[model samples]
Every structure is written in C-alpha cells, then in structure tokens.
Target: MSGEGDTPQAIRKLSPGRLVIASHNAGKVREIAELLGPYGIEPVSAGELDLPEPEETGTTFVANAELKALQAADLSGLPALADDSGLCVDALGGDPGIFSARWAGDAKDFDLAMRLVEDRLNEEPDMPRAAHFVCALALAWPDGHVEWFEGRVDGTLVWPPRGGNGFGYDAMFLPIGGEQTFGEMDAAAKHAISHRADAFRQLVAAVL
Candidate 1:
C-alpha cells in the first residue's frame, strides 16, 4: 500500500505543457483546471477535444484513472490527466468506490443515489455511518510514461444532508474537524482540504 511521500519507483518527472483532462465531467475538469492553474500550463478537457469516454474496466480507482489517462494521451498524442473519485462508507465495506458513478444510474441522478444510500442504511441502523472520500490521479504521457497518486479524507455521513454548495455526496459528508458539510463550504474552502487536493499535492511532488 502506498502512502504520502511514498513515490512510485516507476514514476518519473513530467514537464508542463498542453495537457488533456480525460473526463466528460464538467466539475472535475473545472477543479483540475484550478489545481493546475498555478503551474500555468494549458489545460484542455477530453470533452473539448470530442474524445470518447472509455469503458471503466479497471476494478480499482488507481487502475481506472490510469486507464483513462493513458487512453486520452494515446488518442490526443499529448500528456493527459485523469481522476477517479468516490465515497467509501465503512459500514458498506468500502462499497460504491469504483461504482460510484453507476450508483447514480444512467440518468446520473445523484439524488437517487443518495436516497438509496439512506434507504440501505436504514435497514442496518446499528452499523456505523463512518465514511471517506477517495481520489486517485493519474498522469500519462503519449508514450505511456505514467505517474499516479491516491488520497483520501475521513469523515462521517450526516442524515437529511446539508447545504447545496457541492455535488454528488458532498451534502451528506462532514469531514473530520469540520463544522459544516462539504456541500456547505465554498469552493476555495473545499479545495483547500479535499481528497483531490491531497492527491494533487502528491502528484505535484512526484512529477511536476
């Protein structure tokens, strides 16, 4: 298992240039753009290039992120970055990790997903509601040189949800040491202490 500062021995440094974000998700693209803003590199989305969303065949978040990045890099002949993130509830035995998107159904209805989570948990009220968000970032070059990092933030689920500032499961998750749910926090505040931010910090250290 890898932890912070534990760089993958196979990973190498990458020079900043035109990079493609391998995702159709608008929010993800925006968040990544913000993260890379300081580096002053041109960030383009796969959607912008009309790239197809590849099947997420990988079973784990890291593998899925790498798969997407490498696919986009190969298609665009440029450096590509990808992120696979999810909410893992301990009570659910880390479920909805890779299938987080699927939980939203084909309609991408996260409201239904959240309701499902609540309904399922209602069946087992004795179980803990502890959960965490996991994010895996993969950076791949056209030639297939890859660097990846994983980050996670611990928190607990709050019933009835709170706030409307974030998407997906943010409204129901209250991070450890935080007074409000992620959905209640503003962008700057959320970015300052998010799982993606942690993964970005690791990737920057490993291969910026």
Candidate 2:
C-alpha cells in the first residue's frame, strides 16, 4: 500500500452538477466556462460567489493552481477547478512565468505589463523573441482529492501587440506557424489551440 499522496488511486470522474471556477479574472472564467460548455457541468466563478482571492505563493503553475482549487473546494463545499497560467519569455529566462498577473499591477493593467515585456525584449536586441504560454489546471474535491493537468504552446513575441480580442499577453504572442497573435483571434479560434484548451483536452480525457 502507498501513502495517500503517492497512491495510484483511480482518477476521479466529475459528476454533472455545479462546479466552482476558482478565479476572479473575468477573462479566465469566461474562457473556462466556454470550454466546459459541452460537459453539462454548471460553472460558477469565485468572483460570483464572493470568494476571496487566495494569495498565490507557489513557485510553479501547478502549485498555484492546486492551491486555488483546494481553497475554493474547501470554501464552497463543492468540487472546484482552477487555472494558473503565465507567459515565459525565453530571453528573460522564463521570467513572469508565475508572476504574469502581478506584472499587470493591482488595476490589472495588462497594457503596462505588455509594454514592460516589450521593453525588456528591447534591451536584449539580439536575443530571439521566442516565448511560450503555460497553463496548469487543478480540479479538487472538498474532501481533499485533486487532479492536475498542464499544457504549453510555443510562440514568438510580437511588437506593438496586435488585436484586442484576448487578454493578458495574448496580443504579443504569435503561435508557431500562425500569423495572427492570440489577441487577434476570435474566442472560438483561440480556444481551439490555446494552452488552456490543451490542458482542458487532457482533463476531458481523464475526468470529464
């Protein structure tokens, strides 16, 4: 027999019912809700439930995601799902990976954050503009059970950002082999190939 943390227990399947989306960001909540649309799971955001935003003290996306999910599950007394995502710039050694949102400041001013990223890249004039988006999703039950899934999408950083369709660093990120940045793509288009979508695919396969 193995310890609870290390035991290879069967993956828990989510029953169709109310689920808490453990996040306050409207963009993230909307995206997640859309992805969960076909699953028959009723999704409610943490903001809607007046849940406090948990301080993300974890160093990695996985840690932060699990932290949020568990907190929501414990507070709401329902199964909860959380996502922790960030942009990792190759030239900057994956800087802002877990602190992506913090760079936007308290106002959630991503324009300032995007400018900062561009300015940093300017300092390294010769370095490649390669970057990637990472998303970690954690699903937790009130009883302390959890499952994790992660995804990544590689791309390059563009200058002047692009469209206003998506949020965060979406405007500056051009997916590999794609001309339009994520900010330029419509929700459905972006959803088809985003890091979040990638993670959702894995979750769907395992537990949805």
Candidate 3:
C-alpha cells in the first residue's frame, strides 16, 4: 500500500549496490534492469543466479511480489526487487489477472494466450472491451523489511493484436489516448508510460 511519501511507516532507503531481480521472465528482467540503470545499482536476475521460481499462491499482486522479493533477498543475502504484473480484461471480470502467466500455459506461448483471451471475449460480445495492466513491485531486504508500490495503466483491447516489440499481451493493449499499442512502441517510449515505469517512479521517490 506504499506510495510516494505515503508508506505505513518509515521504510528503509535502498542503497546503491548489487540487487536481485526476482523473476525468471527475461522481458521483465530487461525492463527492470533498464529502470535501475541510472541508479548505481547492479542488477542480477534470479534465473541467472539459478534461484528457484517460487509458487505464486498469493491472492493479490503485492502479496506475490513481496513473497518473491523476500525469498530472493533471503537466499541471495542482498536487496531484491520483485514485480508481479498482469493484464486484466474488463469483459473477463478481471480474470487472468493474477493468473496472467498461467494463461499462457506451460510453454509460455503468449500468442496462444492472446488467442484464448480473444475467444473468451467472443463468448460475450456485449461486454466492454476495456482493460488494464497492473504492476506491483516489492523491494525487500534480507532481514525481511519490505515496501510495496503498485501502478496501473488503463487501455483498450484490440483484436488480431499488433506489433511484436513487447512481450505478453502488449501487442493488443492500446494505452488510453495513445496511437500505438505497447507492443508497437519502442522500449524507451513504452518505459515512459508503462505500469512498471509508474511503479518504478514511485519506488524511486520513496526508496531509491
């Protein structure tokens, strides 16, 4: 529930040094690493360190993110940052929100996942096509101190998908008042307005 200057209590400030990115997703790791680039933080991926992916049994994004971050921090003995993000389609009643990745199945075939979303929407054509991306970021220290920040970007779902630059459901998500879908936009442009970027900004304000 932490936002800029709105934490429940005084949170520990993150000193620049080696930090772990608790995620096995390459695209996610890349995006987070890009955000940490300007800071004096050295980014390392959990997969790179051979960290086992923890079961995401949490009911909410913040809970899952905090769980991963704490696990990584404890195992690596360093500060760790974890991100739990997902696409929520309004028509689907926020389904596939926390289960976004699982929707991709075992192979993580996002193309198939996108098609499944489309098919689900087809079942209820009268439903609204509005959707959004949610990102919850958790920064945890080895001792268990943690801070969570969340961000969201509202958008519409487009059919047939577009572009191929971004990963997951980015190809079909058009940001509000935006001409290009997240997948169509370059990394720098997407980073400027993405849900992850929004949360990262809050993290920077409160802890960076």
Alpha carbon lDDT at 162, candidate 2:
97
TM, every model: 0.94, 0.95, 0.95
Candidate 1, residues 51-141, lDDT tens digits: the string is 9999999888988998899999999999999999999988887878888889999988888888888787788657788999999998888
Per-residue C-alpha lDDT of model 3 across residues 1-208, encoded as one tens digit per residue: 2533455332678899899999999999999999999999999999999999999999998889989999999999999999999999988989789999999999999999999999999886577889999999999889888888889999999988999998999999999999999999999999999999998998898887
Over 1-208, each residue of candidate 2 has an lDDT whose tens digit, in order, gives 1122342232789999999999999999999999999999999999999999999998889889999999999999999999999999999999889999999999999999999988898885587899999998889999998888888999999989999998999999999999999999999999999999998998898887
Candidate 3, which segments miss by more than 4 Å at Cα? Answer: 1-10
Higher-ranked by lDDT: 1 or 2: 2
